[model samples]
Target: MKSKTLLILTGHTKGLGHAILDQFLSLESVQVVALSRSSLDLDLPNVTEFPLDLSDLNALEANLTKFFPKEESFDRYILINNAGWIGEVKQVGKLNPKGIQRVMNLNLLAPMILTDAFV
Candidate 1:
């Protein structure tokens, strides 16, 4: 039997993340765990989808274990932190504070927290 390969991906519902997920799913030995604010439409046997908001730091921290459980089951583990939010395109000085915070939380804080939990 082929060894199990686990892939944890964020922002997997569209764009580049979705493309990467498509490529990974083609390999029969790989199992994909996807996290996105919007649920994915894929119904593949090897895919597990988690609809989540990465901007909520408290919820994300509390649920880290649920996303990354004991690693003993897989022969290899891969984490792809592809989720990001590009805040308003205006100048930094004119940017809204709340928007900046939301972007930072999603693009920076969430990935760091997830990476720490995965490692």
Candidate 2:
């Protein structure tokens, strides 16, 4: 049987993304596209991994073609925007400006960017 849906899941190497990936693995009708900074420890045949640093907006945009090729077609597309980053926990005054930007870029901007590209 052919895959009927394409699932683009971010942050697949850990936490919530990892759990979601495990569940998706059992579904034979869905093809998974996982993006993460590190490769998944499990070598599942149904999943395709795209190693990416989502926090790097420029790089992410530059690599969009490789992840989302225009030639590939799916009956449906599901994007799980699970990628996020919580920078060092401390008093607001102690937070470094660069660190704050990184957190926002990963936790906020990255999702919108990916969604835009997906659409």
Candidate 3:
């Protein structure tokens, strides 16, 4: 039988994202499309790894098109936007603007673009 649900996860190699990926894989009806800045070592049969920086919109869009082509459309798409930062220096003004921008790019902007594309 074919899987109808598609699970898109960020930071798939570690942390909350990895845990979510693990749970998703356990469910029989979902196809896990694990996204990360680098490739994950999970190597599960139901999981397809799409390593991406997410910060790069052009590359992300292109890769999304290639990976999630319309011909293989998912009935239900799950976007787990779990990639984020908790402040670089762990302080208010001490936070690096560049680092903040990187966080925003990965955490917020990438998801928004991918959401628009998914719809």
Candidate 1's C-alpha runs over 4 A off are: 69-72
Task: Output the number of the TM-score-best candidate.
Answer: 1
> Per-prediction TM-score, please?
0.90, 0.89, 0.79
Q: Give the TM-score of candidate 3.
A: 0.79
Better of 2 and 3 by TM-score: 2
For candidate 1, the per-residue lDDT at 108 reads: 93
RMSD score of candidate 2 (Å) = 1.8
- The local lDDT score (0 to 100) that residue 96 gets in candidate 2 is 92
Give each model's whole-structure lDDT.
Answer: 0.88, 0.87, 0.76
For candidate 2, the TM-score is: 0.89
- TM-score of candidate 1 to 2 decimals: 0.90
Better of 2 and 3 by lDDT: 2
Question: Each model's number of backbone clashes?
Answer: 0, 0, 0
Per-residue CA lDDT of model 2 for 6-99, tens digit only, reads: 8899999999999999898999887788999999655776688988989899988988777664666788899999988888999968999989
The alpha-carbon lDDT assigned to residue 40 of candidate 2 equals 67
User: Per-residue alpha-carbon lDDT of model 1 for 1-119, expressed as tens digits?
Assistant: 67988899999999999999989988988888899999877789888888889998888887788775465488899999999988789975798998888999999999999898888
RMSD of each: 1.7, 1.8, 2.5
